[model samples]
Target: MDRALGLACSLQFLGLAGAMIPLPCASHAHVWAGECCPVFWGDGSPCGAATGRGRCQGVAGPGAPAGSDFRARWPSYFFRRLCACRGNYGGADCGECRHGWQGGSCQLRHVVLRRELASMSPGQRLAFVRSLDLAKRTLSRRYAIYASVNATPGAPLAFRRATVYNVAAYLHYLGSKTVGTPRGPNYAHRGPSFLTWHRMLNVHLEQEIRNITGDPSFFVANWAWQGRAACDVCTQQLFGASRPDGRLYPGSVFSSWRSYCTNDGPFTGNMSVICPLGNEMPITRLNGWNWDIPRSVFRGFPSWQDYYACLNLSQYDTPPYDANSRFSFRCALEGFIDPLSPADWGIHMHNAVHVLCGGTLLFSHQAANDPLFTSLHANVDKIFEYWRRRNPRSRYPRGQVPIGHGANDYLAGFIPVYTNEELFQHSVHFGYDYEYT
Candidate 1:
């Protein structure tokens, strides 16, 4: 059903936009000799020859674990060709330098710092909030969300324009929702890829914002979750606060901000028809102070001891790497495994913070609509980095990983697709690190 609907949308889009229209390429390079261009394919090699950055290579077939679940959605067999970037050169076609590295030859490494949101001064906080609002209105220059895909010859590729925030939301949906196979569970979450997937998402978002704002130093802010009950960043000064009547304050920048993709109907069946509705609604702010979730302690935030205990878990993830397992990185970092029982139900970290935020931030699908989502995830990423630093020898699951979370499996819906393994090194390879005060 999904494949057929996707084909129909592709045909319709082609009919309206002309069949011969070239498919979108991320490298900003023109189609070469009328061939369907894969990511990183520019001029000749997958990575263009501008600086001898990378070369085109064949993708390897799935090995071991035989018929693993990860291969269900993004069939690596179909996408057999890819660009292998060399040296510090990165990106889809080696067109741009890797994170932290810059200049013509891609030989510079500068510090990319992510700071706590509450620590920023009043002026800096105001600029950050305005930048987020601007990003909401700004259309992405390089990418578009394709509504459908038809690999057949001369088939039209159905696509729609999306704002910077909309793209982030779409990426989140694609990662969290089941795709490719019907009735399949989400591949990115409930497994080893949870942290890795979001890390890539943040990296992609940061790059987009940098392009939009033209500020190379811009980085997402983190929110400290332990022992803090109030949504300190949720104010007219930052993400915006609401009045007692449940409306945005008059002077808040987010007051005029609108949300996209509010409709959840298309997600149940074929995702090809899912496009940003662009339905503008008043920003919903459920401040932390007013709402209360059920917990043993009165304050919604987790105790510092609970956080330290999870951090001390030795294994990266336990057997059966799904959400149910305890003492694993996936469940521990997610704050789902009950610290009290170690195997039963408990919420202390990431999930607690989301529930405490309420409104759009509480729901996984709509969370990105609120700019605070970025800060929340940045802090989560910071926690993962902290764990990695503490256990320097521990590594991401390399063998026997679930289907969608495999080391080499391509992340769904991301252009210039990255594998989970490629994202294992948080700061060293990617060129960014977290700083806590």
Candidate 2:
């Protein structure tokens, strides 16, 4: 997988690469080193003071007022000190080189080429599956995903260690569900931040896997779902097929996997309760099957025309950008208003595929529990990158927007926070490119 993509590190776009400092290692990638060190961000990770990659340092508040939601202030809800890394090293745990660079010295630039699953060779496919299973079993070194009992600033919170794969799933749930808080549509959706936040998630997941496997070129492959009625990635060799009973294939790796946040109910109607990051329920997927589905969520995959229409919209975002924005590329791409006809209210692209997949992929808060959720999102990020390349839009809206969707607001559920603007640039800024489609 190491292909030697010889692109050197340069600051052609000063604004996008400003935070990427040229310390002995690098900057912009910080970590939270609580009580673990020899290992990092997760199990068997690196970048510790002992390893000369990073050290713990004290931090200031996130500048939120008293009585603000716990998540609104992010890591402030978790820690006052942070593991600041040196050199080109960066990530949630400072265990890897920044996006573009690679190697123990951290000076090489390797813009990884992320591809579709079908393009992977048989050996590559098995390696990817094995790596995913390893990630699911390996617990993050000292990190824990917390579940809040209520929305109040000082409510009781529960914390538990999760596997690296589960960490990604819980972060997605965190981005979508606000514990007991019924604030707008959580952090990563329905606005300009939609593209940036999910892109960051994909990037973070990719890095963690790389660190776990010691495979510098490890990238999360996409499952391009367009022009196909069946879930192409659903096979024992890939993500394993499911039985009618809702459990995954008996002997498959995913069959042993369980979902997060299965216990929490919808809090929009009553913000008093929060979703638990649950493992009791299995990931149930019935692609294109409506035989016994209690209700009809959309069926079949999106067509090529729908994908093109969404990408063709020129506006970054219009006024009232939270799911109601019209004629906006971000809105259309997020699958709110129809991209072909702005007046139509049908689900189109992103949202359409979620419901089309059915079961675990249907619910926004718990969708990441399904393994291909990452594949689904890898495609989503590729589409956004494609749109940005063709349409050339603003990083974010200038006017006041929703709480976590603002340009300057730190993206929820990340340490060494990134703003909507920080990640709004090209994927190459984050050290990866897509071979999507």
Candidate 3:
């Protein structure tokens, strides 16, 4: 009867009753290869590497004036020049002056791809699919990654979409301003427009897809959390009790917990804490969802395991329990699956492998491997294309979904030219290749 579950049940009811559109299709293709790494927060951001070839042609020299056209052209120029040379090196300029690489063209010398998934023959594809299916089944039985992380303090929780978007925007600014690390000396970051940079990056990724496919249809997929749970206590009370109220918020079940989570908003580790549109909703009426209630009534705190256990259990095992922890992932993929794409599917499939493997392989470990995290996000980016296709009519304002009061206005004011249409056209990180078969 908590608020999140109540909301989810309402959404489910609407979806099942055909009040809302159902997803158009299930996932058909999988990604198999590519750079799955921590979304590199560049050391000398926005600008290319520091000691590379000379700056772009006809561009401003070091410390170019602000709002200059040269400043605008830098990232594009760097991406093209480096991608041309396969990104064997990185710095402020797209030069051949980086370490861990050699040659005038900045070619890498020693790295080898581990079992290229891109060039598999038909027979190989069948074998790989069988193996992948088995692997997924094995993984589905493991503990949720967030569940383990929440067991102890200091574990970093998964970044919500808005927060991750914010982080990416900040990193984009740092790179564009050529700021040293966020906390380093001589940093000159003038925080850029979050919406502007986010859109720019989306464009950049879309172009990459087009370049590979010679077609613009290949795009990214949409990835949405299947909203919170629905119950009696949630709908009759609380803000966001309905769909039009807004979907993803940033806060928690209790005011105190939400306040603690967002106090240092950028670094909160409590995944259960969320921020939505119910800030003004009173907590006094929260008969069942409040924290600090007596343990005797509830038995124990509803840890991640409890939620999972409750999900599978036939009956409630204890009191003071909440069951909104179950989450399902979906994607947007349409343009990406057009005819005659490229090897992008392999790359995407590889990303999924990394994600599934990371979650299961690291189930018992305290820390996740760096490569695994990268691959996981790579899968997330790839899935965006799928999400969009599944919910073609779903719209957004300024690259975000609207839910409650001032929601549209808030996004519009924050991003004047941004609209759902513009965002929908190009949010993918890469193109797809139907040529895999």
**Model 1: runs farther than 4 Å from truth?**
1-23, 26-46, 60-80, 148-157, 179-185, 245-247, 266-273, 276-280, 288-299, 398-400
Number of the top candidate by lDDT?
A: 2
Comparing candidate 2 with candidate 3, which one achieves the higher lDDT? Answer: 2
Given candidate 1, what's the lDDT at residue 171? Answer: 69
Write one digit per residue (lDDT tens) for candidate 3, span 78-110: 112211112554322232223234455655342
Q: What local lDDT score does residue 361 receive in model 1, on the 0 to 100 scale? A: 64
| lDDT at position 395, candidate 3 | 41
Against the hidden reference, what TM-scores do the models get?
A: 0.81, 0.79, 0.22
Candidate 1 per-residue C-alpha lDDT over 1-437 given as tens digits, one digit per residue, 9 for 90 to 100: 11111112343312211111113442112222222233444455456654477766655544533331223434232234555678877765666787778887788885688888768788877777777777888987666664333322223445566778778876675555454455333555667888888888888888878888988888887877677767777777877787764467888888886665555454423243343344445657666535454555223566687677778887878667765667776677676675544666555577667666666666565567777888888988888888888888987786666667777777665645677877777665676787854
Tell me the tens digit of each residue's lDDT in model 2 across 1-437.
Answer: 00000012222111110111112222112222222223463334444666667776665445765443445655443445555778777754677677788876678888999888989998998888888889888976534555444343223444445678877886776677542334345577766788888898888778778878888889988888877777888888888887876567877788888775556544422223333443358778877545443322233467787788878778888878767788888887777777778655556677777766777887777788888888888888888888778866445686767767778777777765567888888899888999854
> What lDDT is obtained when candidate 3 is compared to the true structure?
0.23
Model 2 CA deviation exceeding 4 Å by range: 1-65, 78-87, 92-95, 148-155, 178-183, 265-279, 289-299
Clashes of 3: 65
Residue 142, model 1: Cα distance from true site in angstroms? 0.9
